[model samples]
Every structure is written in structure tokens, then in C-alpha cells.
Target: MTASAPQVPPRVRVSEASLNVLRSHTDQLTTAVNLHLEGTLPWYRQLTTDERASLRLIAQRGIMGLVNWLDNPQTRSLPLVNELLGSAPTDLMRSISLQRALQLIRTIVEAVEHRLPGLVPVGDQQGMLEAVLRYSREVAFAIADVYARAAESRGAWDSRLEALLVDAVLRGEASEQITSRASAVGWGSTCGVVVVVGPAPEQADAAFMSHLRRQCVRFAADAVVGVQGDRLVLLLGGVTDLDTGLERIMPSFGPGHVVYSRIEGSIDQAHRCAQAAYSGHAAAPAWTLAPNPVPADDLLPERALAGDDTARQMLRDAIFAPLAEAGNGLLETVTAYISAGHSLEGTARELYVHPNTVRYRLRRVTDITGWDPTEPRDAYVLQTALAVGRL
Candidate 1:
């Protein structure tokens, strides 16, 4: 069963006599706040002259907000404080935290309450103290409301900035702007990174992103997730194992093709990795028997078939060039092995060598290209790489 929504706080009413007492001493209350801040808050002394002035202004506006809320007790307190604090410069909100702002409110409330006995009549003093407590509560809620809005605004802006950074990574655009943006989104320059691409879930929204972030935290990883068209791209960092990380995050994506790039040293080289994942994602359907979370390199045959030059060059460099460099008849042995229907004896016969020599050369082939000629899948990739390199 679903839970019920929280009820709103009840509005508090202020007595007419207390309201008059507060209105007459607005300047006194403001001065009291200033003196209390200087004596109690060491950080207040560290603020710039303009920042101090802004704080004083917010405090003064806060007093006026209380008076206004008192005048129209039935009106919402949120609008009352928001309207008052809205006049302060937006930058002030950044300089001050919610806890510090609440401290500021407490000081102002205490300063006002301290002077009540002097300004208010004896009969009205009790009423004045009660009004002060209620007014303080309302002010506290208003301050909380303002900060909540600011937090939401900051979160939205960060999400957009992160999306732009991911876009730059995918498009292979290396610029100072990309670096600056990556830093802004907390992407460490030296962290190991990988890019995962797949179709996005249907209801991709703030809640979904929050869930994805929580998953990252659970796995001790950092990520920037973006939805470009139907594709959801996640740039994961601090991951020591791409395959392990993929296993944990696989449930976050919709079914279809999910491809992860090999771990890269830094985000700067992430674009190269992202390109491979992007190309592989497009070509993944061709590999009907592909694993759920397939490595981008595993799709090299499909990528090469789709005319991706990057994939073609990757195949040539990773497979063909290594064998060619080893020389020692390794290249011919590979060709002959596949041509001999992966028969060790047949390749030995074709190369006019002992069967053991063919076995040793096949082991050397595995060491050179990290692919086993005996495995059907590895043999297919090797055959494709040789064909692509020759073309």
C-alpha cells in the first residue's frame, strides 16, 4: 500500500497588541540581530563587506516578513518569507548554508524576544512572548522553504551541465569547455572511466536518475547519465572492473543492446571509448547471440561490417598487426589454422611442421592477440580481422 502525504503546518495567529509592539521596534530588533551576529558568529566577520550588508538586509527583511505574517495570520507563511528573502541577491544563498541561515533566524528571534519585556505593556508581555515563539516557527519554515527551492534549482542546473558533458564525450569533441564541465560535475580527471550505452527505460525522470545515482553509490562508483534520443549513455568512473560494474547496473537499462567500453585511464580519452560503444550499440543487433552486457570490442565484426572505420582500425591494430609483428610464420599459421577448419593436425600438415609446433604457435597466437583460435567465436573474430586488415 502507498503512504499518505504529509499534512501542512497549521497557521499561527498573532495578537494585535503584540503585532503593534513588534512594528514599533523593527529597527531595534534589526540592531539586536547585528550585535548578536558580531558577538556569536565568527564566520560573520569573515564575510565581505557586501556580504555582511546582504546578511543584514536579509535579517531586516526577515523582521518585516514576521510583521507581515502577523498582520495577515491566515495567509501562507511560505509566500511571506519567500517574498521577503527573494529580494536578497541570489549569490547570498550560495554563501550561506541552510544551517547557518537557521542560526541567523534563531539569533534574530532571540534578539526580538529579549526586548519584549521593555517595549510591551505588562498585561501584553505574555501574549508577546507566545507570539514571538509562533512567529519564529513560521520564519523557520519559510527559510526552509526558500532553501528547498534553491536546492531544486541547483540540482536541475547540474543535470543539464552533466548532459552536455556526456554529449561532448560521445561526439569526440575535446575542448577546454568539456574539461571544465567535467570538473563542474565532479568527474575526476585521473579516475579510470568507462562508457555504457543502451536503450533508455520508458519513464526516465528525476526519480530514475536518483535511483541510478544510488546504484552507483552502492557499487562505489561515480557516473554521469544522459538520455540522448532513445539512447541512455552512462559514463562510469572509479570502476576497477567493467564487467563487474556492468553486471550491477544492467538492470537499470531496458532490454535490447547494452554495450560497455573497455576501462580507460581518464575521462579525456573517454570519447574514444564512447565512440566504440556507440558504434557497437548500433551494430549489436547483428550479433543475435550477443551477451546481455556485451563488450564493445566483441562487436568488432558487426561494427566493421557497418562501415565503422574506428572498428576496422581497431580490428587491424588489435589482432592483425600483433600477429604480423611477431612474424615467425605466426600469421601463416593463423590463416592455415582457420583454413584447416581449426584442426591442429591439418594446420601442421599444411605448414609442413609437427602437430606440437602448430599447438605452440596457436598458444603464441592467444598470447599475441588475446584470442584463442580453438574457440569458435575467437576464431571468427580473428578471421574477420584478417579479412578487414587485408582490405
Candidate 2:
């Protein structure tokens, strides 16, 4: 005959009598936990009556979960900790912090352990004590696992909602849905909103966005970002200065010109801002010396040259109309100055005016248009705006 293998008993082997004792005293274990909470935790006293009742139910379930684990026939069967704790209202999580939840768990476990000697037969005391300790550990792990899963689920849903909001802005879809969705993503009217457009970095990981979010928080801003192919777009709010906020976040973009929009009062209006930034970003390469975080309005010359109607109209409004409306011979003087190859003496001699008079008019031009005629960069912008306005 073949020799039989030796049978190994399970780790927990509570006798029928010990199981009966635990079942009969489940109420006692629960009451002990309640008394411990009332005596030890001051915060517990602040909770509403309903909240305290819900917590008591959870404690009761935990004690019964231990009893079920001890009496379970399958040696390797784990306690149904999740089911026992699942009946607790979801609102409890919002009202009670995880630290407080852990405190409650610790108190309940201690109560059960304190009463374990009387609850179990003397011969089975040590095994029962050890089993209770192991079960409590399992309960703690289960609580952590539940909270982790809850947080992961919430994060995933938020990401998808954020993607949809970004897509709507990129597509220029303004509707009631956008307003409701914006609120869901934490956008509000009180904060200044700005849109930033740039090329998405190669091989960027999710952690890159995580770092970007932390940076935004440091600067007292909130951002909703989406990466579409090589394009990355962000709608940022809570910033008093768009330029300063972008300075903190610009390092996360890929190697290319990034464009920022004018700050608006609300994110609801940011789709227009996003459109302008994207337009400028498309025309950004035309200005080789453009700063990394160039303002969308600053790219008007290039954008207008690229046949953007808004850019053309902007040039007409911001540059030509202002000079035309000032009417101190500013428009005629500017035309003559550019035509004179930017020579101060040449412009004065051609216009039959004193050089000081021409210089004074140029200062007036700078004040009206926020552009200096002598600087090469500002001169190019003025010349382009003049050419577009005349057309």
C-alpha cells in the first residue's frame, strides 16, 4: 500500500464551543467599542447622532466579521471584511477622514481583544486571540484597499471629463454643456482664465502632467490640460497674471514656441482665447525671434500675414484705427517715417517739419499704440500692421 501524506490542519481552528461563545457575545463586543469611542475620542462627540449610529453599525459588522472568520469551515477562507463594511453610507467618507476611520477601527479591534479571554473557552484562548489579531489586520488592509479603489475610480472619471472639456474648447463648441462641465472640473467665474498652446513633448508620461499640476498649485492656479497628437493645450485659471503663471509651467512643453492668450474673467469665454492662442501658435514660426511664451496678440502680424481674418481685424483696430483716431498728423508722420528708411532727419526733412516735431509725434505714436517706432521688433510690427490696415 502507498503511504498517505500527512494532513495539515488550517491555521485557525476554533472549536464549536468557542464559536458559540463569540456568537452569543457579539452585542457585548459592539457595546465595548462604543464605550471606548465615547471615552477616548473627543472628535467622536462632535459627530451628528446619525453619523454616530452609522459608525456603530460598522463596528458591529466588524465584530461579526471576526466571528464568521473563526467559525468558517474552509481553513484558508478570508473574512468578508468588505461586505461587512460595505453597508456604511458613502457620505461617511466625506464626513470622517481616513485617520479618524483608522482610529475607529483600532478602537473596535482593541475592544474585541480586551473581551476575548471571557468570550472564548480557556483551552482555546491563545488561538482565539491570535486569530482576532490577524482578522483585525485583514480589516485594516480591506479598508485601505476600498479607499484606494475609490480614489482611483474618481481620478479616472475626472480625467475623461477633463478630456471632453478640453476637446470642446479646441473645437470651439460653446454650449450650456460646456458651462456645466467647466464647473465639474473646478473652473469658476471668480478666477482669471488664460489659454496656452504648444507642441506636446515626445514620450511624455502621465507623471509629467502630475508634476505640472503640482506646479500650478504652487502658483495658486488650476489647469485643465489635454495632449492631442503633437499639440498640447491648457486652460488655466486662478492666475492674476497669465505671463507669470506660464513662466512656472513653460518648462513642461516641448521644444517649440508656446503661445498664451489674454487673461479673461471666466473660463466660459476661454474658448475664444484658446482659438487665438492656437492661431498665433500656428503662425509663431514666422517670427523667429519670438519669445517662448509669446502673447497671442503679439503674433498678430504673422497671423494676419497668414490670412487670419481676426488678426487682420485686430491690426486694423489696435494699430491703424488708434493712430487714425488720434489725428495729430500721427498717421501721416508714421507713414512718412517708415518711408524715410527710419531716418529721423530724413523723415523731418521730407515732411517739412522740425526734427523735434517729428520726434514728438513718434513719442505720441508709442503712447497710443504701445509700440516704439525706433526699436526693430516694434518697427516691424508697426510696418506690418500699417500694410495690413491699408489693405
Candidate 3:
């Protein structure tokens, strides 16, 4: 006959007597853990009384959970461990980071291990120790899982709030609610802000958007991104150089025109910036030779032709009004220059002045309106401004 396999004893488990002993000492163990944390962790000592009490309650629950798990070794303990920490208030939970939570768990386990010799019989002591080790491991994992889920939920909520704020700015709504939302998203910048608009990427999912946001941070800027249909809108803050910042983040946009609005003084005025960017993005297709990351102001003529009232008013105010206000026949020279195919001699002939006078007036036009009648793009913008001003 084949030799029979040697019998193996069942795995050791904590006895009922030891379970009762551990249960009675749960409060003692909790106190030990809290005292250890207070003595060892500098951050713990800084917590308010209520916050410390909250942590004390968590430690008590953790010890109690360990006892219950020891009583029924096969029972699921992760859920119990999860519930123990899940009851913490949002602020309290944030105060105790994962590292600190794990440190507390280790302290609790050590407290029990230190008292095991007196609490249980020698045979049961090993089983109790093993149980504590197993339970502490589960508790560590539970802490990590809970914190991860909290981060994910917070991220989703923040994304929603960010999108809502972008929508409000686009709608030109600057109320207390908008301010509250901006604060919720940590947009506390009183510095200049701007809005950028482009086509949404073909795959504008959470991952892509997250990467885009990271890119913004890498460039030392803050951004709130919103995808409205096929359009991608971004509200950028704390940028010192708009051109350099835009160039840094240009790759985040899709394969279409990327336009940024004029910088507003602060987030409160970002709605005006958003209006310009929205209008520019809508009219971007009209300018074939426009640069990839063109300024919203650069597209004023196209936006005016597309019936953007704000763009029309902007052109009229920023371009036409200044030239019209400045005397010395600057407006007449600009009109005559454009009408004469940007010919200085032709304009001089029309104005019955020397070409040098026409050239001097053209220089004045550039200085006054920030646009030149000779450059093709500036000519178009000036011509549009003149038309809108006439209208």
C-alpha cells in the first residue's frame, strides 16, 4: 500500500477567550495608538481638538474591527475597514493623509502586539498576532482604496464645476454664483486672464483633457477647460507672456485654428475675453493665411463680416474712433490710400499734397490706430473698421 500522506493541522485561529480579551482592551489599544501618533507625528499635534477626536474615533473603530475579524476569521473585513474611515468628515479626512493613516494603523497593531503576552494564552497569542497582521494589512489597503475613490470623485466634481464656470463666462454671466464657482476651482488670480478657443480634439476624453491641464501647469499657468460641442474653450490665468504661453500649449489643440483673446485685467473680466475668442474661432475659417495660434484681435475683420456685433463695435472703437479723433487729415489719407490701391503717390495726388505728406500721415495712422494701411492684413482690418464706422 502507498504510504498515507501525513495529516496537516488546520491553520491556527484566535480562540473565543482571546477574542473576548482583545475586545475588552479595544479602548486601551485605541488610546495607545492615539498617544503614539501624537508623540511621533508632528502633524498630528497640530490638529484641532475636534479633528483629533475624529481620529481617535477612527482608531477605536479600527481596533474594534480587528477584534471582530479575529472572532470570525473567514468574514470579509475590508468593508468593515472601509466603513471605519469613510465616516470621517471631508476636512478631517483631508487632514489625515494616507501616509499618516498607515502610520496610525501600524501603531495600533504594535500596541496590540505589545499587550498580547498578558491578554491571551500562549497558544492563542500567535494566532492573535497573525490575525492582527492580516487585519492591519487589509486596513492599509482599505485606506488607500478609500483615498483613491475620494480623489476620483473630487476630480469628477471639479471637472463639472470647471465646465459650468466656462459656460457662465461664455454666456457673459458675472455674478456671485460665478465667483463662487471660480473659488471652488481655486481660480483666485487677480492677475490678467485670457480665453483660448479651438476645435476639440477627435478624442477629447478625460485622459486627454487631464493631459492638457497638466501641460498648462507645466507652463506655469492655470486653465479651466470646457468642451462645448466641437469647440474647445480654455480660460488661462497667471500667464506672464501670452504669446509664449500660447505657443507652449498650442499642441494641446486639435487640427484647426487656435485663437486667444486679449488679456483681461482679471477673471472678472474674462467674459469679454471669452466673447472675443468665441467670435474669432467662429470666423477663423474665413482667414486662410491666418497663423495657427492667431490672436482673437487679429480676426476682427472676419468676425465683423460674420456679424459679430462685439467685433464690429471693437473695430469701430479701437480702430476707427482713434483715427477719426486724431486730426491732421489722418482718416482721409487712410481712406484715400486704401482707395488708391495703397499707393502713396496716388493718395498724395488725391489729397493734393506731396507724397512725403501722405507718407507722414500713413505713419500717423499706424501710430494712432495700431494698424498700417500698407500691410495687407492691417489694410483689411482698417478697411473693415472704416466700413463699420460708416455704418
- Kindly list the per-residue Cα lDDT of model 3 for residues 1-391, writing each as its tens digit: 8999999645447778887887888777777778777887788899889888888887777778777666555555457655555575354456787777777677767766887788788888877788778878877776777777787787778788889989988887856777787888999677778789998988987778777888776554678888999989888888767677778878777899998885647776678788889989989999999998988889999999998998999999998889888989988988999999989889999999999999999889888888888898899899999989988
List the lowest-lDDT window of 10 residues for candidate 1.
8-17
1-391 per-residue lDDT for model 2 (tens digits): 9999999755787788988888888888888889988888899989999899988888887777777777662323223644655666354476687778778878877777788887788998988888877887777766666666677777667777777888887776766777778888876545477788899988555667666767766655567777777888887777665567778788889999999885545666677688889999999999999988999999988998887888888889999999989998998888888889999999999989999999999999999999999887888888888888888
Instruction: Give the clashing residue pairs of candidate 2, or none.
Output: none
Model 1, 1-391: lDDT tens digits are 9999999655555457767877888888888889988888888888998888898888788777777866666657777665766766364576788888888778877877787788867877776677668777877787687788888887778789879989988887876776787898987647677788999999888778767867765544667888889998888888755566678888889879899885546777787789999999999999899998898999999999998899999899999999998898988998999999989889989999999999999899999999998999999999999999888
Error of 3 at 212 (Å): 2.2
Task: List runs of model 1 lying over 4 Å from the truth.
Answer: 1-20, 89-92, 217-222, 240-244, 263-265
* lDDT: the better of candidates 1 and 3: 1
The weakest ten consecutive residues by lDDT in model 3 span 83-92
List candidate 2 stretches off by more than 4 Å.
1-10, 71-79, 89-95, 170-176, 188-191, 203-206, 240-244
Off by over 4 Å in 3: 1-12, 74-78, 82-94
Report, for all candidates in order, the number of backbone clashes: 0, 0, 0
lDDT of 3: 0.81
